[model samples]
Target: MAKQDRAVRTRTALIESAAALFDSEGYELASLSTISERAGVSSGALHFHFTSKAALAEAVGQAAVQRLEGITRPQVDDALQALIDVTHALVRALDDDVVLRAGFGLSDSIERVRVAAGLRDKWQGWVEDSLGQADREGALASEGAAQDAATALVAVTAGLETLGRQDEWWLSHAPLTRFWQLILPRLAEPSRLDVLVASGSKGGAPGL
Candidate 1:
């Protein structure tokens, strides 16, 4: 049991160190030796856990996938409201979590032929599903607005994530709040608009 726990800890540390390096420097630039040094593990230990940098990169991506799952797992009573809160949560994550930023960055890397879908792809899919649900709930203003809103939402959030890497202000609550305030009115039915909180839920994003 102790050995298993130690292995888990070691693996986690390597993933974290690799994620930080990947975020600061692109995948091609982040070296295995540096990742091992940052993780405080011997090269042998790192090899025991991940045979190659590509393997380690996949682990980081999979870890990020788990986090994204947690973020999207909890559902609010209102579908549109949930969408607003999720966008807030996702941006906040991009700003705060190096792993998430790195995972997303990995998705953008042309060098890597990743086995799993990119984080951006995963996020866009979720946004589309949420908007579809909102339309079904009669929360949207029109029949086809969901697809349009999904595209805009994905583009805006992806832009914010990309820009936020340089300046954190792009990911802050103000920009997202303003975005929601601008678009929610147009996307939501008038009756639904009054109830939607542009910033987020009164409490916070679910599964936080």
Candidate 2:
């Protein structure tokens, strides 16, 4: 039991160290030796946990995906609010800078390439499912184009991450928040539901 516990600790440390290094330096430049050194574990111990750098990278991606799945998997009661919630959760999930840098930005051709590819597919499917649900609930306007719109949403988020690294200017200029805000209104008819923020005292338009 003690041996197993120690192994688990070592694997966790290695993954964390690898993720941090991958975030600071691109995957191509980061090395297993460096990761092992960072974790204060011998190279042999690192190899026992992850046979190769590719394996370690794959584990990092998996860990990140697991974290995101937990945050974004809630059943959204209000379609409009659901998207908003998803956006908020996604942004928060990226708070760990390494997640944005290594999980999404880096190439995923690790030893477990299939597993990495599955993660990408899972993301696309999740987006499609969420968009489909919103469309049914009259929270989105893509009627005939929900799939395309969902794909575009994914693309934009990925692009924003890459652009965010290059310059802070993109952070404010990017229309991520606005894009969703604009789309949310178009998804359903105006009178079907209140578009503006609800208040105790009525008489104001939807707060834009």
Candidate 3:
């Protein structure tokens, strides 16, 4: 293999191994040696790819964010819908134990504080933008409540994550449906909520 490809593969291996270990053992208890051994690479190679366990944890969190972005980027139709869609998509992606661990662990890591803050800002931005669009499109029912809705949406999703299952990894379709049922009707074109409900997809986008 080319040197670059080989290096990338090794990095992938290290990240995957570290994600699994961190998920199962928690960040403090998971060791570099265990991750390096699981990846079948020398500690030196692991160090070359990621300088420390905290670095590896940050990488895992970043990877989880990337995976979620892939599923959600095209799924949002407007601001509120985008918030709903992306939040749902994110919750769905957490079906994996590694993602669960990374997300759960992100809350407690001082080393990854910047990453956590960036993630929060990203979500908040998306929510605010979507609400702005919904207002432009005349699809917002609560005329002056965009900011409040965005904040509430974030809070609700966080609560859902805390309340939901930690193991077994799949998104609970039933709970998701219930959430939609409750939120969709509050929109401007309240009757057209069926489009989202029937499609079971966001943004009414194909290939999502």
Candidate achieving the largest lDDT? 1
Can you tell me which runs of candidate 3 are displaced by over 4 Å? Answer: 75-82, 97-104, 165-170, 202-208
Query: Model 1 Cα displacement at 200 (Å)?
Result: 0.3
Model 3 C-alpha lDDT versus the unseen true structure: 0.66
Task: Go through the candidates in order and give the clash count of each.
Answer: 0, 3, 3
Alpha carbon lDDT at 203, candidate 3: 43
Tens digit of lDDT per residue, candidate 2, span 1-208? 9999999999989988888888778778889999999998999999988888878888888777776676555543655455455544554345444653467644465444445545556667777787787678766544665776777777766666666667644444234556665554555446644652221112111111
**Candidate 2 lDDT score at position 74:** 50
Please give, for residues 1-208, the per-residue lDDT of candidate 3 as tens digits.
6999999999888878887887668778889999999999999999898887778877777776665556556455554555556666666655544654464556557556445435555656766777777778777777776766677777766666656545332356566657667766765476556554522554433233
Identify the runs in model 2 with alpha carbons over 4 angstroms from their true place.
Answer: 107-112, 167-175, 192-208
lDDT of each: 0.86, 0.64, 0.66
Name the TM-score of candidate 3. Answer: 0.81
What TM-score does model 2 achieve against the real structure?
A: 0.78
lDDT of 2 at 132: 83
Residue 30's lDDT in candidate 3: 87
Cα lDDT for residue 195, candidate 1? 83
Clashing pairs in 3: 79-130, 79-131, 95-169
**TM-score per candidate, in order?**
0.95, 0.78, 0.81
